[model samples]
Each structure stands twice: as structure tokens, then as C-alpha cells.
Target: MITKVTHGWRPGGLVAYLMGPGTVEEHVRPRVIASWDGLDEGWQPDTGPGGALDFQLGRLIGALQVPATRAGLPVSGQAPPGRGYVWHCSARLSATDRTLSDEEWAGVARRLLDGAGIATTEDLGGPRWIAVRHADDHIHVAAVLVREDTGRRFWPHHDYRGLRCTARELESELGLTPTALADRTAARRPQRAELELAARQGVEPARTELARVVREAAVAATDPGGFVDLLRGRGYLVELRRLPSGDPIGYKIARRATTPIWFGGGKLAPDLSMPKLITRWGQRGDATERLDAGVLAETRQTLERAERILRGARQGIAAENPDGIAHAVGDVVAALGARYGGALGEAASCYDGAARAPYEPVPDVGSVGSELRTLAGYLLRPRRRHRDDLDALSTVALLVALAALVQQIAQWRAEQGKRHQATAARDAQRLIRCTAEERRPRRGPPRPRYAREVAVDHSRRENAVAAIT
Candidate 1:
């Protein structure tokens, strides 16, 4: 399992993201795990058209704010009363364990919350929080940072490290496959300014682009010197750091000759560091043996086609053109299915179908692919009133699913062979950078004045259907 934690300032945004169908498909409704009153029933009421969930969320935030002001904490007057520290966590299980029941999944989530120091109010007199299960393999937990008994803020030191440790322990206890943990000791990753700049220029994020180039150069090089020279030839500024005895210790790379922003090797990834590279491939030897030229070319072409399809879908969604978005999403579903299906066929043909028998597609990819296909069906046959909401929801779901598929394909290819690793990494990075550019937080399109009325109408329709059923 893998765990990620993010700090936010608003609980409402988190709640809306989890409870609403925008990020998740309509078939997979989110399940509430915990709330302000510790109530387990009436999950549907909070999500009803009356805004009961938002109101309850407001009360919880209010409780936290009263204590914070009395404790003289830094409270911004411009922000809403409920606007404070919010920690959003996602704990994801392995794809192979997709058969786990809802009850079993919730049990795992509760245990994770307890282990991560968010289960009880004992530490700081209780903080209001909620856990919502969404998607297939993960659950999200949103918590306010202010303690109810004392208005003081709650910030856990070394929280990410603690979360990883807890995840590893849980993996063993739950008999789940263990995945890699991030190396916290490595150099910090580059900040987002360059990435945002790349977005503005209609290019891939600078960091990911540079990392991809460096990895490809490393794969093709005969030695460390060749690696540095290849990168320099490709418009990167490579600076190698060495010990007093002249042994290489680390390195920094920049996008251009004049750029002030340089990212350390370790910052790109732990394996990219000079020490790690040397340990794996040695100071002077072929980086890797080459694969068949025809096979490599075919793989690259397939990946490029997939990337283009996804990029078109992303662009359509960003422009908010519903018709164009639907067309592009359908293209993505077809392209991805063809790509994966072709690869599977090739594997089967190569070894008389035995080598491919054990190969299973990534769980997240399969789930998201199914959702996108279903979404396309809905987009083709839309209802009259819910067209706008359906468009937005399908767009968000497609974007989210596309991101996961890109990451999964990257990992899958890296495991295939050394020759395909660099190319796979580059394609994956390109897709990721493009998706990030499209989804970066910005001022959304203006809302209509009658938005509330439209929502009320939709809610009434839903309530009517519920009553009739």
C-alpha cells in the first residue's frame, strides 16, 4: 500500500471532491466513515440537495475556530470561519487485492487512521474529521487541525515518514504486497514554478522533461563521462560534484546553459543520483544491451499514439467544450484499449501464450478504463437537464483515470526490459506533465447567476426518483 498526505485550508473543497460525482463515477458512490457527531447512519442525508453535509461540516469547523481564537493562534480574518488546517490523506491498496469487501476495506482504513495518529481525540482534545471511501482501491481522510478541547493547532512532525512506516507495518499484518517507500534523505524535489512556466509555454514540465532526457542519456551511454556529454549535447548543463580524491559524489543538471534553476540528481529520483548510478552500472561499461530495433520502434509508436489521444481529451476538457470533450474521451478509451490489447497479444504469441497467462493489467487501469467507457456511453446519450453536470463530472473522472493509467504504464514498461525503460519513462513523464498543466489550480470559468436554481431543480428530480423507487 501507498499513503499520501496533503495539507489544505478548506474542508468544504475536500468534502465536495470526495462526496460529489465529479471525481468518481456515478455507479461508485462514496461511503462516509466518520463525521462530527460520530453518526454511522444517514449517510445519504448529508449528501442530499438541502446542503446538510455542508452545514454539518460548517458546524465542525466552527467548533475548531472558537478554540483556535481563544488560544491566540494565527487566524486569517479574510478566510471563512471553517477555513483552517485540513489534512487530506489517501491510503491505496495494491491492485491484486481488488476483491476485498467494503467492510474489510473500511477496517483497514480505520486501523490506518489509528496508526497515523488521527483516530482519537486524546492527543489534542479531539479534532473533527471524516473518512470517505471512493474509487476502488483507496479511501480518503479529511481532518481539521484545530483541537476541540484546546484551541491550539495540531501539526504532526515527520508525518510523511510516520505514514510510510505505518503503511509498511499494515502491509505485513494484512498480507498485502509491499511497495517501495520514498527516500526522504534524498535531495528535495524541484518546486512548481518551472513546471507552471512550462505549462504557460505549452511544453512538458521542466523537471520531468529533464529527468526523462537524463535517463535516456544514461541508458545510451558507455560510461559516466559519456552520460554527461550526451546530456550537454542535448541542451542540458551538467555539473558533476566530486570528492577531494576526484571520485564523483553527486551532480546537478539545468535545462539550459544560462538557467539559474538547477535540479540535483537525487532530486529527480533516488536512482538518478550519481552514486547510485555508478553503483549500478559501474564507472566505465555499457549501460545496457539494446533490444530489437523493430520491437522498440513499435512500442514507442504505440505509446505516442496513446499520449496524443489523452492530450486531446485533456485539452477539450480544459476548454469546457462538452461535444469535443466527449469525442476526445472516446478516442482515449479506444486508443488505450488497442495499445494494451496489442501488447497482450504480442506477449501471447511470443511464448505460446504461457508467458502472458500470468500477466494481469494494473487494477487501477482496468477500473478507470471501464469507467471511461461507461462515461462515453452516458456522454453519447445525455439527459436534457443534467448535461452540464454530467459533462463536468465525466471530464474530471477521465482526467483522474488518465493520470493513473500513465503512471501504471510507466511502471509496467520499466519492468519489461532495460531497452524500453528510458523510452517508457519519457512517454510517461510527458503524459503526466501535460495532465498536471491542465489540472493546475486556477480561476475556473465564471458561474451562472441561476446556478443555485439549477442545482435545486436537479436535486428535486433526484429526490422524486428516490421516493418513487
Candidate 2:
């Protein structure tokens, strides 16, 4: 499950977008899962048989607006008059979870809204919202953020994080597959426009590519200087933040030599932060490095190539041609199978080695690997039948699954790199300290006190004889 929350100053446009037929298809009408009114009792709008859809929509919008007007709050300076705080959110279940009924889904939506502190009874005085089920496996909820009786506004604190936590809890309760939680420090992913550009240009998106490069460089380089040089060789412009005395405090990366836009290392990835890197490379000097420049570069290029292949396949799928879809699915299956299989094998090998050590148990990557292989097999022989039997929706699901698997593998590999780097750095530091101790000079044993006094008296007598002569 995933939840997206966004707020605006107007409800009419948002309500229309959710309830309008244009959201799904011209022929398919959206289903009103549930509706409520804060001002009136038994005010469920007529969305039943023989009821006018337009009238129901108007009633829905009116319910959303009445609270804002009754609150008597000033219009948001960011928007024009008659526009107040409108809280819009969507909760989407995985496409595979298609057995849930409209009522069940609505319950999930309500729980999420309440958890996120958006449409709570205490906050709004009453339920003043509507949940619309779209053709897709998702529900859209629109509510007025202003209280109807007290004229108070409700702003959710840390709304995104709250939504994520609620979604995770719901996933467990609903017996759904759990997904990786969002990293608070992770940069905003590439937008749809950037993805489309990458597809059109037949190149990997800059943000994704940059993140991959940064992660690899962070693991392979022995010291901060080496890390900077490694990134420079990879065609990324590196900017280092320094103190007045010329000590590096932080760093950022640009996509190329000429780009003015830069992303902080932490923004690119949590592990790529300057402080994290310093911790990984303790007592940093020229240490024994494991991964060389060639290996790192090759790995990055392979990832980029795979991304390009996936993008091309997605383009073909978008065309909606039967033959094209088959070809696309085959290409994706082939490319991702090899990549994910290799990653899984590597992870398994590392896990085996770590298991021999007395350290904590390594997580079982075998299960994830097995899942990836199963997904690959599904793509290879969908429906246990011929390719001609493949439906568009099934093909789309396969594509989404393939993408998810790829991302999972990438994350696994990144984590493995961090562990390897830490181990290598510790070994290197031990070696350095041992070598320094071996080379250190030693002092001769101290002479006895009587022997030292006799030598001193002899030297003094010789000096007196020379002075007399």
C-alpha cells in the first residue's frame, strides 16, 4: 500500500478530477464508495440507481465547500478568493490485491485519513469528506481542512511520514506484501517529465544515474580525496564544502560539467552523506582498496544500459501492439533475470561468508532472490500459455513487477557495498597501525648509575689537564 497526500486551496477542481469520468475512461463511471456531510444528518448524496450523477457531484462539492466558508478563515494568500485549504489524498493498493471490495477499500481510506490527522472527527467536528473509487486500484479522498463548527484549520504534522507509517501498519493488518519504507533523507525522485525525456532521448535519467554513481564511488574509494577524484572521472562535477581553513565539511554533485543545479550527497542517498562516508573510511589515508575504478565504471554502465532497455520496453508496451508487447516482455525478462539473478547470487555468497563469522546473522537474501526468479519465470511464460494469449493488463502488471524487482535488487546491492566497505576499511586501519609500530625506533638499555658516574669523572680530569698545559 502507498499513500500520496497533497493540499490545495480549492476543492472544486480537485473534486471534479476525482469524481469526473475523465479520470478513468469516457465510458466507465467512477464509483462513490462513501460520502458524508458535517452540517446535515442522513445527508448521503443520491448516487444510487435513477439518481442524477451531476446532482450528486454538485452535492459532494457543496459538502466540501461549506466547511471552508463556515470557518470564516481568510482566503489562502497563495490562491484567489473562495479558495481555502482543501486536503486531497489517495491510497493505492497493489494491483495484485484485486479481491478487496469497495467497502473494504473505503475503510482503509478512512483509517489512513484519520491516522494522517486530516479528516478526524475531533479535528473537523464531523465527517466532511468523500471517498471515490477510480477504475484503477486506488481510492481518492477529498476533505475540507477547516473545522465546520469552530472555524479552526487542521494541518497534519509531518504528513508524509505519518501517511507512510499508517500505510505500513495497514499493510500488516490487511495481509498485504510489505514494501520498503521511504527514506526521509532520500532526494525527491525524478518527476514524470524527466522520465519521459530520458525515454525520448534514450538515456538514463540524470538523478537516477547520479545516485548510482555516488553510491558506487562511496564504497570503492578509500578516502574523501579519492572519492572526489573517482566521481570526477565518471563525468560528475564535484563540489566540496569547506571550512575557512580548507577542511572539507560537505560535498555535492552535478550531472555534468556545465549544469548549475547540484544535489547534496546526502540528498542523493543517505549512505552517500559526507559524515557517513567519513565513518566508513576511518583514519583515512591511502588504504587497501577493494573495488578499482574499472569495476565501478563498468557496474554503473551496466545499470544504465539496463535502465535504457527497460525504458524502451515500456515505450513499446505503451504502444499497445500485441507483437510489440510480447517483444517488450521478453526483453525485460531476459535483461532483469540475468541482472537480478547475479545480484542474488552475490548476496547469497556474502551471506554465507558472514554466517561463518561470529557476528550477527545476515538477512536471508535467498527469499528475495527466489521471488525475483519467480517473477522472471512468470514474465517468460505468462499464463502457462502462448504469448498470443497475453492480455494488456497482465502485461502491464508484469512490467510493474519487473521494475519493482529491479529496484529491490539495486537497494540490496547498495547495502552490501556499504558492509563490504566498512570491513575493508577496518582491516586497512589495522594493517596501517601494525606497520607503523614495526618501523618505530627503539632506545638502547640505560647504563648503570656507577658506570655513568665513572665516565663523567674521567672526562672532567682530562679537561683539567688540558687547561693546566
Candidate 3:
């Protein structure tokens, strides 16, 4: 079975919508958490002997509405059959050993459901919590993120890497198998390279590294185009500009490349200043003149420092203090007089090594973003798979490979047919040439045709005559 999980900010503002919608009107009393234990049959009083049918229907609808309740941020409101928000999200269990019976599978799911329910009360950070079984194939758990102290909805302004980490840890505690976790990890997109680079550097780089790299390169570049092209070749995007009014007016120069090269999710500070390049090339002053004196010196220092820190990170210098590397990045950016973009948290989140960096203009060969992201996400939600989990993942891999093989064979056959036709045409041409050079058929000396070519022609003639007769 496939296992996957997806999470993000609750769209459309949770609290307002769920609390506002009158669907759960009868049960929307302002209690912290109202129980449906006795109220199930009451909600839809119809012909039922023991209320079993009513209870089951209520449970399904209530489970579905947990997310809605969670979205609105009012846990006090009732999460009746069809009005709860699905907050924490769902997770699937992968099998490895011999397949268990339907009853055994249900037992595993019940335990997961129990774990999720217990986790909801015990680990009360995210919103509403739920665990659902898809027959015996999988389990889906959804939990809300809310303030435990005040019961107010908590909206995360940025992407929370910590949430993913929490998910991984919970999965592991729930006894998910490694192979199953691996499969789940593979499904998520890889983290950004810049973050990986930062983690490697011992700490994440400050937000300004992207600009500094471009500024320094632009300053020293005799040909800005050539320099930008070089950076692009290295997977960087460079932006050129000009100053319309400053002392450097009419000056053409290379400014900073795009900030947050990858994962430009947040905003930038308005006051931060950057060098401007003239729109019209060869406007007035020398391109070098457009480069600010202080900027050039500072850019050089920043670039050198960035290089040193990058080297240190790669060498695992600050493994003990992840924050150290992050701080250093912040310092480097400040020293270069660069502003942090709106994506600082996202950028910082990327430090987890699971986020995909924005597409680099230049790609670093041999990089593994997906693998690292999987690891990073795994760090968040670890699952300790049982033996059966491992077997299941292997089975899945085999199935995938089998599917790919079928496709490969089809392609190979098409290519082989083309090759066979080409060989036939070549043999026909050679035979024609041999016939053209022939003096007489009876008692004649053989011409010096290549031995292999002669054999191929003879084979073709024999096959042709056989087919005709």
C-alpha cells in the first residue's frame, strides 16, 4: 500500500468558517468539547432499534467535519457528524511480512487510531486529530493545530519544518516500518540545495548570501554579461540595473541577482537599497564606474567569508550547533548590507534539508535534493516499520520495476525493428554493388570484397530465395 502525508496552513481561515456555518447548529454549544455519546440518535431521530445505524453515520460525518471545526479555531463548538476540520493529516501503514487477515489488519488500524486519539490529548500542538482506516489497506489520521491554553486557533504564518519533524517522530513511535517510511519520504518533493549547503556549512547561510554572490561577481566582472552568464551557467539568476537619480545616475551595472534564488515564498524589506544598472547599455559612464566603492570592498569581504563558511559547513564544522551556522549566515548578509526577504522562516525551514531550493540557473551535478528532503521530512515524522512493512515496500518496488520493464521492452522492440530494416537495406546495397562488379557467374575468381560483407550478402540472397520459393 502507498503511504503519504501532506500538510499546510488551513486555507480560508478555519475559525470563522466552521463556527459560522449553521450545519452543526444544534450541537454548536460553546463547550470545550461536546460528546456525541448520547446525542447521536437525537440528531437524526429515525426508525432504529439500538441506535447503531445512527451512531455509525454520526461518527463518519463527525470525523469528516473535524477539519472544518479545526479550520475555524473554536474547539468549543460541536464536531457533529459532518462539520469537523481535518487538521493533522493522514498517514498510511505499509506492510512487509506475510499478509494478515482482515481482522488482524483492522486491529493494527485500531491501534493507530488509538495512538492518534491519545496523541491528540497528550501532544496538543496541532489542531483536531483523527485516525481512519481504509479497509485493511491503509490508515488516515487528521489532527488540528490550536492553542491548548486559550483554545484560540493558531495560524502559522510560515511553513513549519517542525511540523514535518513532529510527524516523523510520531510515525516512528507508532511502529511504522523503515521501508514504509522510505516510501512515504520518496513521495515528498526534495528540499532546497541552498539549505542543504547551509546545513553542510555547519549553519544555514543568512538571507543575503544570494545577493552578495552576485554583487561581488558583478563588481569584479569586466563584462557583466559574461559574469552573469557564468553565474547562470552555475545555476544563478542575475539582474542588471541602473540608477535614475542618484550620483550614479545613468550608470550601467550588474545589481543583485534574484533573492531567495530558490523558494521565494516570502516578502522582502522595502528600505533595503541595491545597486542599479542602466536600462540602456553604454549609457554614459564606464560599467565599472557604476560599481559602488564601498559595495565592491564589502562584496569582496562577504564573498570571501561566504566561501570560508561554506567550506566550513561542508567540512561539518558546526555539527554541534546548527544555529551557529544559521547565525553566521545572518551575519554575512548583514555585513554585505543585504536585507532578509519575507522567506526567512521558510529559508530557515529549508535548513532542515527537506525543502527544494528554487530552480538554480546553474545546477550542481550529483546533487540529491529528493533524498535529503526525504531524510529531513523523515526527521520530522519517523515511522518504525515492522518486518511486514519492509516486505511491502520491496513488493511495491518490484511492481514499479515490472511496470517500467514492460515500457522498456516495448521501446526496445521498436528500436530493434528499425535497426533490422536498416541492416536489410545495407545488405541490399552491398549485393547490388557485388552484382555490378561481377564478371561471370560460372567458374569466376572472387573479387576482393570484405569477407564479412560477402557473407552478409550471401545470407540475404539465400533468405530472399527461400522466401520466394
Candidate number achieving the greatest lDDT relative to the actual structure: 2
Residue lDDT tens for model 3, 279-341:
111121222222232322323333334334334444655222222222222222221122223
Judged by TM-score relative to the true structure, which candidate is superior, 1 or 2? 2
Scored by CA lDDT, what does every candidate get? 0.52, 0.53, 0.33
Question: Which should have the higher lDDT, number 1 or number 3?
Answer: 1
Model 2 TM-score on a 0 to 1 scale? 0.53
Model 3 compared with the native: what TM-score?
Answer: 0.28
In angstroms, give how far residue 178 of model 3 lies from its true place: 2.4
Report the lDDT tens digits of candidate 2 across residue range 1-469: 8888776876767776765556335424566676554322234345646443442656666656776777774333457555347777888778776557776777777777778776654553753677777556777887777765677777776777778878888888888756545444233477787799779979887776676666556544556898899899878899899889987779988876444457887666444578756654442223222323322232233334444443444444322222122212222333233233433222222221111111212122122222222233233222334332233333333334433434332333234443332232233223323333443345699999999999999999999999999
lDDT of 1 at 128: 65
Q: What is the alpha-carbon lDDT for the whole of candidate 3?
A: 0.33
Model 2 lowest lDDT segment of ten: 353-362
Candidate 1 minimal-lDDT segment of 10 residues:
348-357
| Candidate 1 per-residue C-alpha lDDT over 1-469 given as tens digits, one digit per residue, 9 for 90 to 100 | 8888876665656666676665335415566755544463234334445552333344434543454456565444345555357778898888896455566665666566666676553453666666677578788777777677665677765667777777878788778877544333222344678767877879767676666556545434535787798788877889999899998888899876354578887677545678655643332222122323322232233334444544544444222222222222222333332223333222211111111111221112122233332332222222334333324433334444444545433343334332233243344335434544554456778889699789999999999999999
How does model 2 fare in lDDT?
0.53
